[model samples]
Target: MDEDYDYFQELRDFLGGTFHQDISSPEQALDEYINEANKECLLFTIRYCDEFLTSNRTKQEKENYIQTNAEIYFPAIGLTPLIWLNNVVEQIKEAVKLK
Candidate 1:
């Protein structure tokens, strides 16, 4: 979907929150902070990607599903599930580089 929101700004905003109680809350620290519960939720959302690709639903229906699910699970991100998933992937990539 074509969205106008600033991607980096969302990351910045999330990192600014007090979600993590340990470690410095740097963007690079995202991977470390995503505990098991968050990981399970993210994985659950990600598993829908294949369904989104192959389903016979109309484009709008698929988009709506993604938005609804994202809002339910990750309202703080204020982004569609796919977008949030992409952001998570980017965070992982960055973390991997530090290893």
Candidate 2:
């Protein structure tokens, strides 16, 4: 979990910095970039989880990693991070259901 936390913390910081530089106002940013941001977040989460699942980790570990990182990564876009994170989680769940 520590390793997962550290990896995601670094990813979160990088993405957060990028978003901060790209968007000046949260409202305007949401209006213009929400879809792209949400897509990126969802893709990242899915890819990360998929890769993690291929590793030696258990299913619970993969789930824990996703949940832990969601709190960090989803908010990187600077426009209602928690809400975006929730939306991303919902999207992920829906995708998993289709699989």
Candidate 3:
């Protein structure tokens, strides 16, 4: 995809497509739940990117870290954690390239 893709927009689109019915505002409870989950994933991605940039971890180690943490991050969001991580990593790489 485009190098300048917005991870949050991709995430929102993924959720909207996957859980279209559940995301409807009429389903207030479910909508709120999904929103919270989306927020958590976005927050986690930002923090992980910052941490990855500062850490001395090797690329493999960084991938492993994401793998290990996938369980915690994927439960509510429903997307496969590895896929989400890969997208986030790509975004981070692109950001670094522009810096």
Which candidate number would show the highest TM-score if scored against the true structure?
1
The residue ranges of model 3 lying beyond 4 angstroms of the native Cα positions read 1-34, 37-45, 72-86, 89-99
Error of 3 at 40 (Å): 10
Q: Could you tell me the TM-score of candidate 3?
A: 0.31
In angstroms, give how far residue 10 of model 3 lies from its true place.
22
List, residue by residue over 12-99, the lDDT tens digit for candidate 2: 5533543454566534443343344455454555554344445676656645554444334334555344344344445565654544
lDDT of 3 by residue, 1-93 (tens): 345755444544443443344333323433343445544454444554555545676666655555453323355555454455455556544
Using TM-score as the measure, name the better of candidate 1 and candidate 3. 1
The alpha-carbon root-mean-square deviation between model 1 and the true structure, to one decimal in Å, is: 12.1
Ranking by TM-score: 1, 3, 2
Q: Provide the overall lDDT of each model, using Cα atoms, as 2-decimal numbers.
A: 0.44, 0.47, 0.47
> What TM-score would candidate 2 get against the native?
0.29
What would the per-residue lDDT of candidate 1 be over residues 1-99, giving only the tens digit for each residue? Answer: 124544333333343331333534333354444432354433432334343435587766655654443323345546665565456556544444444
- Winner on TM-score (1 vs 2): 1
Off by more than 4 A, model 1: 1-30, 33-72
What alpha-carbon RMSD in Å does predicted model 3 have with respect to the real structure?
12.3
